[model samples]
Target: MTTSIAQPSQTKQPQHVDPAKKRPKVLIAGGGLGGLSLGMLLQQTDIPYEIFERATEPKALGSAIALSAATDALFKQCNIYDEFVSLGKKTLSLQVIANEQRRVDYKMDFSAQQQVLGAIGHVIARPALHDLLFRQIPKNRMHMGKKILSTDDQGDNGITVTFSDGTTASGDILIGADGAYSAVRQNLFKRLKAHNKLPAADDVPLPYSTVCLVGQTRPLDPAVFPHLLQDDCQFINTLGENKPWAQGTVCWSIIRFVEESKTSTDDKNGHSIVDQEWGPEAAEAMCNEVRHFPVVSGNEVNPLTLGDLIDYTPKDLISKVKLEEIVFETWFGGRTVLMGDARPLNPAGGVGCQNAMHDAIILANWINALPSDPTSKDIENAFRSYQDERLPWIQTASNSTRFYRTMASGGIVAGLLRFCAKHMPAWAKRKMLVVLGGNRPQCSFLPLVEDKGSVPPAFQPSLLATKPKTPATSV
Candidate 1:
């Protein structure tokens, strides 16, 4: 409850050692948000680490992401909160509409919630967030186009990671921050199975009943899209009538402000737009689905349709993908461990990315807490502690996301929740917000640079964020 971070020990300065001789080198798989964030944290702590990514280039190839109050706290600790706030658009309220009638059915105002929690939720393009994290990491430490083929635990010496390009690297520990289809996780499970130590139901794919299509629209004209400019409400969700589970459609659209200045196409950081590829068939199919669906707003005379939004979006940015859930039973073995999507979790609650960031912080904390020249057993123990501290919260967040995804998927429970959410009294809604928004974990090593204000005692430091210098070149 409101636990303040313990300052670094004044008497014992962290011993600097030759990285090649004494320091334990951390090998990170994947270069997504979690991996990159972890690299930044390790840099801040002077922890030796290397990041390997299969992708040939650093490209943020997704739509928008919602950063909650908890995530906002992490950003502030990392000294990038101001950058994020400036680049992203804050969402004040959520409006749910009936697809058939083209009218607003429910609205969840977040103004009160923001005031209570002291952190406002913002919606920003995925690429923008990626660029922010990527810039913080040094060029030499990040290795792109290196696909990991397998990993071998070399007992006390270290772990050997073999890449697809016939190269090998040894590190004290291996972390799987790769996304859903993680090669590191696959290898870990395989090794466990070989040793007959695999847990029950450990590597099953997450069940997904919903298919989502997401894209960002080009800068909107305030004259043509006045409702989109309103800070009062930034996001809108449209749900079909209740149907059998996983059989109905739910569409979510947000007008993201990719840039603050209309005249400037280039971001304030001077990065030009990176092109992405979404096949023609996929784009056509997504546009076909919502071509006629009304884009309803509060009492607007005429609203745009899904097709109009897609038309405004760059063809390359649109994407269609199924949403799935997975929670791994085992997170670590020997010198290798899992984090972010590799751990058991789903992407529904809009908290997946935030949780991924949390994983980096917690794991880094445990790792950084070890001695400068830690033994193999010491590293293993730190990993065990990392899983112990994080597994329960990860499970809770996964369940919450599952519940929300089910409710949004159009079913009996979905109808019930919608009814309750629509008719719930203001006080009841506030109470619900308090319950959902409480107990968020902040970074432990970083001091709270900007307090949003007093939050509930439930808000405490369970994770830590870090800063990095120099940009890394692609391998």
Candidate 2:
């Protein structure tokens, strides 16, 4: 069964409000996917917002990202669905194999995702997706090299964020969409800890059980790489003794999980652990370590290796990063809130980017409905509403991510999961797909996209709770 996308009959007209209108001014920390997406959503409303990034310029950093129908509605509402589909290749199945023996373990079918959930899953290079999101945002609103040093939530007076360059900016709301080692989060945690209001789990340094090295190769010739000739992506995973490599059409990630959490200040060799660092030196080290790993996608006669992919990838585009599994108990406080990697997750299941965009969608809904002159209580309530609607979904995604990670491991747990996955009934698989792709959150302020799946989407509270009272004007 296949579900067809119906073009929206009407498009929502972009809100053109006077710049001087006293609406809630949003200050976003980070210019990655989350921040840029939130900014794009906010652009549809009368809300004022600006994005700040620590990087001097955007680097094409990450490898591939998997997007499901969970965000297809939001993309259609934002008028970027067509372009997103064009840039991505639809993924039909995930084939997992034992790396050393080259034996097939199990294959998870996603061909029915379109029929059951509304849209097929897509796998695109992260840089291409990032560039697509970046193009939607205005140049004037996105500030580069503005590292957030600290935040001050001044009750009803509004919030203030001080940057590394000794400059300050004020806004009605502060969103920490920065990555795992977020300065905005560190600053907020400091103030919460001073009052003994921070959760013990949220106060400590982020823990990581795995390190992932991700990179995308330059476009390859279809003649040389026969897999590239396929119309749809064939997602593959090769599970080794301790290292698992998840392969996309032109991108890949080599993940090595440790037995225990490595959260120490320094490595065993006495060198400081820069977990968030994506510098090429660290990436190169990991690249060389996994260069000889076997790739299961290629034919036995022409066996491919990680070194082939690495050689095709530009040096500057590779990155080594940590994967944390904890879903922080506290998401928002006062006027400060967190989104994206600030509330980190292990990306074993490729749900991190999806959750980040979902967070932005929900947060933007609540922010759009805010009163122009909101009091502290009103601000707090809005922030709470954003978290209330987003937290449960984040926790669910985190749980699934962990389970998938375990399933890819070489332990007994992984063996059991593989057995179950191989024997999972077709009905069970479809049910799981429905559960996984059910939450298709859309902007309440924009014209809603018609649902095309057989199964209805999960209930979205933010859509009903924060919808604009007046019908959105259409172009």
Candidate 3:
């Protein structure tokens, strides 16, 4: 399940010329995980691409961690996994510790699978990783202070982009590694929605009830969160008023584990886990409700024509998102198409980043089959092969991410479901496999052909083959 990029051994295919190779002048928008990742891939390759980040500078921000197999290897492929690992605290398991009177009722574990996936959830400040990636790619290639105004698809060629500065430029490919709510995807979706290329609103809204708070905290001193130091697993500490309290009452990010991977305790001065915390004050607030405090309703009636689930997530959670999905219905106009989330934004399963990384690796392998030079059709077919082979994995991971988060947040209902699971047959127990994100392909992002609906190529596993003796030891 860990990420493995097999050196491909495919039958010989027609050669394609790298007309856009060494002259790679890609304009990547939004310097987030996807953008930074693609830029880093390009940086490592013979291609050249520049990142146009909307932020004036790479600012330190966003909450914490995510688990991915393909992404870790992508970092390994790009040669940055070790550096990231050293900076991140690896989670070996996803434990569900059902709590009763503050005592452990039961525990469900997930780690061996994470290891096989080559990544457990990784914890690093968003800014920290961004700065690291920003530093990895030369400063000259990454531009700050520029915002995208508009993007237009040019006929049979490329994309024309207009910047906020009133300047325009054309590129062979405009990779909109933009995060969900992407401006690029938005315009494209506008066109598509107008043309009815979108799924019906009812089928898309797909809602579930969840009203929860999600945030991080100041680095907990070892004494503050003793259990966290003893293990490397992320936890859902559930305490029920009934057999199903669903812990948070509504679904939200819960932290039963806390450990900071800062170089020195003194270095922890800058990182803030979240802007708020739920403690005595919160408990008191809950005990005393403010009448008409203002109840807010949400929009889940229609999922966007573009992006992923994110556009539907509450705005309050947007800033907290460390990594967003890749959404591009089109990249490279038509000549050299792009796949993966980079196309229509990869879904947010634990493997989004991994999936994106897998895309690059698969593309590299797919291209290797072609002769040193390739014709336009050859490149087009290569793109098709890449899509046919990789899309299913991307889809599977995306669906898993959505499913896992849903169950994780499943309030009393989800908890009751898990509790009832004990009485069910062994086959029913396997249902939990999806919540653990154990049922998907090992690689996060393999290539794909939408029409063909393909599977991924071979891949290897990660160092997390077994749960670390404890989280501290692993970090």
Off by over 4 Å in 1: 1-21, 241-280, 297-302, 449-454, 457-475
Q: Give the Cα lDDT of each candidate.
A: 0.67, 0.81, 0.44
> Per-residue CA lDDT of candidate 3, range 293-412, in tens?
211111224211111222222433323222233333243323334433434322223455556555655554444344333444555565676666666566666666555444444366
Ranking of models by TM-score: 2, 1, 3
Model 1 lDDT tens row, 1-475: 0011222211212234445545678999999999988887676655689999989998645676777676776676666777777667777777776565766677778777577777777776777778778877778888999998888987787899999899998988899998766788888887888898998687344444444566666666655566655553346666654321110111134221111212212233222232232255755665675676666533355566666666777866666654445677788988899999776354556778878888887887777666667777888888888887777777778788767665576557867877887888988877766655664555565554454535562633334322222388998
Q: How many residue pairs clash in model 2?
A: 0
Residue pairs in steric clash, candidate 2?
none
Q: Name the candidate that leads on lDDT.
A: 2
Segments in model 3 whose C-alpha atoms lie over 4 Å from true places: 1-24, 114-121, 191-214, 231-234, 237-349, 359-386, 409-413, 420-475
Find the candidate with the highest TM-score and give its number: 2
**Candidate 2: 10-residue stretch with minimal lDDT:** 1-10
